[model samples]
Target: IDLETYIYWSGDIGRQFAEALAERARAAVKVHVLIDWIGSRKVDSRDLAMMREAGVEVEKYNPLVWFNLARLNHRDHRKLLIVDGEIGFIGGAGLADIWQGNADAPNHWRDTQFRLEGPAVGQMQAAFMDNWTKTTGRVLDNEDYFPELRPAGDHYAQVFFSSPRDGTETVRLMYLLAIAAAQKNIRLSASYFVPGALTTEELVDASKRGVNVEIIVPGAKTDVPIARYASRSKWGPLLKAGIKIYEYEPTMYHCKVMIVDDVWVTVGSANFDNRSFRLNDEANLNVYSAEFAAEQARAFEEDKTSAKLISYKEWKNRGLCTKLLERILAPFRSQL
Candidate 1:
């Protein structure tokens, strides 16, 4: 199994997984891990040493140094797990205690993780190798990493990967094209809901055209208050165009998913914010299957049960302090 995570914070959950992976390595199971240096700063050196003692192949992504200071803003924010080049997992959930407990608990994030099978797993593995090669300068092209895969499901999926160094924002362009082509409805669940001007305009236009456009975003329980405010500041334009906005009330909503017309579904790490679109490296899976889209649509409906619909009247009647905060933080939306 090959795993990549952004944050591996020090905690019982982190230690437990590290120990489990070490046990697998001791049993002659091939285990390789890649973690971001900045994101996993809290991981103790002793823990890494123990993994190395167990013969687990581990590497850090882009260690911070004076020479690489300029690349600090670019982060490998992808979470992937590929098992024997057959099964794959990807999404926003990281390896930390925050994701272990109930979402209702304080500091416990509500996120989504996905499992992929069939030929799409190969693309997921390739995405992981793309970063692995850049970080370690070692190309992994063995049959174990890229085995022949057969169709295990009735769906067509495409993996879209984006990075700042790629000279183009592929993930962002994917979202733009999907939203632009949406016909019946567009259901989006965004942990961070700051969309660019063109994207926002397209969404509003979709709503104006009588397409059911709804978005689920974080509420008061969000960890990043400034980002929440920035997201709220952009709600006016969307609401005026008859777009429906809902905030999940049970916990911090950390899922990045989108479904269009009950036939197209996207699930992965890229959020609707500018940071994900322009700065961070992200990977998303676009599935073209009515059955899969129906499943995701059901999840969206279940989430809506815990969400509070934000009406245009309510947004207009917000308190003065709230409006001022949104205005104050709007300028920094790009950075957030």
Candidate 2:
């Protein structure tokens, strides 16, 4: 199990999650947990001690040390859970109070998690090992971790990951290529929707080419206020190009999913902002199947019902103080 944020709060939900893993460890399960040090800052030491005492190998990624100060901005944002090298799960969720209940209220966030099997599960395990190896200088490269995988379904799926360490714009290029190749429509649901100038241009071009470009983002329930400000400031061009943007009204929309032309679907931890595309370690599962894409489209349409469309006029008439805050955050857009 690997997560960005694993808050060990004093809530029943938190206790249940921590104890579940500890129980697994006590049952002689080789439970290895990796969490981002900064992201899991709210986690209690006693909870970690309890897990460690149960024989769970827990490690924090990129702890603040003197030698690691230079790369502090880059974080491991991937959420992965691989059980016994068989089933795997990946999405944009953390172990926190906000993720306790279903998205029936404002406090519970709206998110998505995919439980997958087959060869894709092997790729997901590889993605986990990519970080597990980096966090601990040992590799788990045996049959217990990498066993023979059979096809679970007829979907053509593959997992790809990107990092600043590679000095390549992999996730960004993937989004651009998908946008550039979009023919019928592009339904994008991002929690953080601060697309930089280049991506904005690509989206605008897609909109101009008659692609029904629709995006869903968090509205008033956003955790990153500055990211929302920066995102709104750049929506003028997209709105002008006839791209439809909707802000979720119920709660925090923490889903990072994209569907193109009802044929391709990519979902995982990568957001539509520069922070996810450039600075953070991200991973996405790409599926080239129309059947799976249709299912995701159904979910997107349902979420759209709970979203409020923001017109171009509304965006233009935002308060002067809000505009000033956006301008102040413009220079730091890449870091958002």
Cα error of candidate 1 at position 288, Å: 1.0
lDDT of 1 at 234: 87
lDDT of 2 by residue, 1-336 (tens): 433332334455556767888999899878888888778787777778888999889898888899769788989888888887888888888777888766799999999888888888888888888878887999988888888999999999988888888787789999999999999999999999988889999999998889999999999998888889999999999999999999998999999999999999999989998888889888888999999999999999999999999999999999999999999989999898
Q: Model-by-model lDDT, in order?
A: 0.88, 0.87
Worst 10 residues of 1 by lDDT: 101-110
Residue ranges of candidate 1 with Cα displaced over 4 Å: 101-107
lDDT of 1 by residue, 161-268 (tens): 888888778888888999989989999999999977898999999998878999999999888889988888888899999999999987899899999999998888
Estimated TM-score per prediction?
0.96, 0.96
Quick one: best lDDT, which candidate? 1
**What's model 2's TM-score?**
0.96
